[model samples]
Target chain A: MPLYYEKKHQVQFYEVDITSQLTLSSLLNLVIAASGEHLEEIGVSSEELISRHLGWVVTQYHMSIKKMPEKGQTIYIKTAAMAYNRYFCYRSYWLYNEDHEELIEINSVWIMLDLNTRKMVPSDPEIMLKTGAEEIRRPQKFPRIKLPKEQLVADKSYFVEYFNIDENEHVSNAHYFDWMISSLPLSFIKSNHIKSLDIKYEHEILYHDSPKSYVHFNQENNRSYHKLANGNLTAAECVIQW
Target chain B: MPLYYEKKHQVQFYEVDITSQLTLSSLLNLVIAASGEHLEEIGVSSEELISRHLGWVVTQYHMSIKKMPEKGQTIYIKTAAMAYNRYFCYRSYWLYNEDHEELIEINSVWIMLDLNTRKMVPSDPEIMLKTGAEEIRRPQKFPRIKLPKEQLVADKSYFVEYFNIDENEHVSNAHYFDWMISSLPLSFIKSNHIKSLDIKYEHEILYHDSPKSYVHFNQENNRSYHKLANGNLTAAECVIQW
Candidate 1:
């Protein structure tokens, strides 16, 4: 069985932004969806995991973008399981245009959680074997993202709505990026392009939680840090480099 | 060329709400997308209209929903142009589950606009002839939606974001429904099911415009009326029956 899987998708109208380019949040969603499809093809489907009282939760993500696709364009997304340690698994995703030119590359880390106990678990031997991944082919190690503790540069409050929740019954991870990027000035987004992003999922935002986003920008490094919070609880922290 | 066109789609995770059922706004988007594809198949595509300095603009809509599809389900959307008058073209859409069970029925009215002049135009002879519609098969006329003109019960402001805009360089018609529905209380939406909707598009909301939505619920009729506005200009009005 092949370790890598690829899928083609036609960009829908709703996925495009005002500039007619794909939004960052939607791009992440496409990657996650493709990863799920790949998992299903390998026999470790979400249904199978649920039946075992287990689930995969994303922990860290680092993505670099060369170009953003446009509406009606057909793009290919390729994903593969790179490696797995005792408690975490590594994966990589690549996006290509119709001409086969690579447009984006992403590396992600995930951990298995025991749903019944609500705690982290070691990688299951049978599940890891099904992925067909070679430890020797693992990608370079991902660095931990660091966000400076400082006063907020900008902030916004968002009420979690029905559409924001996923089948997992919590706020989808991609939306945290949405709230972070949206907090930036419109002019800055329209004039500049995002080069790279690093995000760390710290806490899960449940339904009915109105989380406030705090942003801090580092002009010297051209980077931005974001924290999503509900009262004293921090839901997630992210850093973006443009 | 057949007058009816059918397309199948797998419901994605983002299209579902907290209940795992398709959101009403997403359902409307599916219908509108199917209508666009039908037009493309008949050679009256958006490109053709733009080349002729014209565009298709929706004016009114009436939809009735019997059931909402769940995530991961494959649904078939069927659409057709029913009839056309001197200035208006009527269309109908139906959604069916994988088992061929009908779930939704929608009727809509559209008008041709002179893009250069920014005004309504008569239906072009060539365009109408290409649709292959028969006047004898027209559906029942849609009733005008009545909304109370009294004081507003709830209101909220929303800034038009990059993702809200479409290829036309303005807010897409379907997003108006999204904003209107999202304005409702989350608890109410989670517990209740939407049965029918009536909407009328009055004005266009442009980029960078922060429009506010005013809502009034009628306890006696079990209906809600909404008005979207950008300061002095009214963007749209909708009446939803649950």
Candidate 2:
């Protein structure tokens, strides 16, 4: 049997941004939902993980966008677990339009965490076996996002509200993208399109924490570096290519 | 033939707030989506509206909530057009849990606008005939939400970003609710459940406008009145009951 899983979704009206294109944050939401469904199919559901005092946390994501599907379009998302090590699992995701044209490709790394200890833990052996996770090495290396060493071009604070937190009691990853992009001027976002993105989560921003985002743009390279900080500590960093 | 149109949806993880219950803003989104689907079934789709240079704008809403659904739960949303006059259309919506227990009841008024003139217009005769809309008066009169005349308990400004704008090039009504609720103390939202809400849209908040929300809470009546203002002009007013 094939190890990959697929799901079909119609882009809702609310998912589109002002440009009438699906927003980057909503796209990530779809990707995460697809991953959750895939895990459930492999008998590694969230409830099962919680029962074991474990939870899955995404550590890194590298994605390339060819085109953004518009509102009211039907898209297909496919994902699979490529490999698993002691403490981390590698997965791949692809989104395509109704015409079977590829729209985006994403690679993500997830670490299993012990809920009580809040430390990385080895994957359960049963999960690997059940999902038929093979040790296939990825052709392309994951991007290592670098933090900006220069002065900040834009900075803004985002108060963690009830809507931003998720089941894990932390700000959802999608909101990280939201805060990063929202820090830029509306004119910049309206004039440019995101070509690629690489992000790494260094730490978690808990509920009631007001995280601030600092951004630096390299106009020559059409790239932007972002650092999301909770007070003095950096919570996450991201690099975006326009 | 039944006048109501119903749709089934599973509450996604991203829809839930920190408390693991569906956020009130997401609930309104579901209701709007159901209404759109019902409109399409009766030959009045967004595309049709655009072709005729006409659009639907929400003018008022009064909603009563008994409970909120948890993530992963299946809920049914039903909506129907109740009546239409020269300048407004009345609609009703209900949300039900898996057991068929009603969770929410909403009544809304929509004004059809001439997209070119930006003025209120009469409903198309064919639309009324196709939907079999009848002039049935509501049992409970729609509340006239009063603007806060007292001291402001909380005030904050939100910049209209690309993600907040909708297909009509204006901030969607759902985002207004989001900003209003997000402005409240997280502690208050976590401890209290929303019992009812009455809101009126006095003006449209357009893109690139930074609107500020002013709130006044009356502890005795468990009511909070809010006014969303763009500079010196008020855009919308709402009264929330907890």
CA RMSD of each candidate after superposition: 2.8, 2.4
Per-residue CA lDDT of model 2 for A165-213, tens digit only, reads 8777788878788788877877788778989999988888887798988
Model 1 RMSD in angstroms:
2.8
Best-matching candidate per DockQ:
2
DockQ of all candidates, in order?
0.53, 0.67
Model 1 CA deviation exceeding 4 Å by range: A135-140, A216-221, B135-140
**Alpha carbon lDDT of each predicted model:** 0.82, 0.83
What TM-score does each of the candidates earn?
A: 0.91, 0.93
Model 2 agreement with the true structure over B134-227: per-residue lDDT tens digits: 7444433697777557676547778776567787778887878777887788788878998999988878788779899888888989888888
Local lDDT at A150 for model 2? 73
Can you write out model 1's per-residue Cα lDDT over A186-212, one digit (the tens) per residue? 678777777888888888998768898
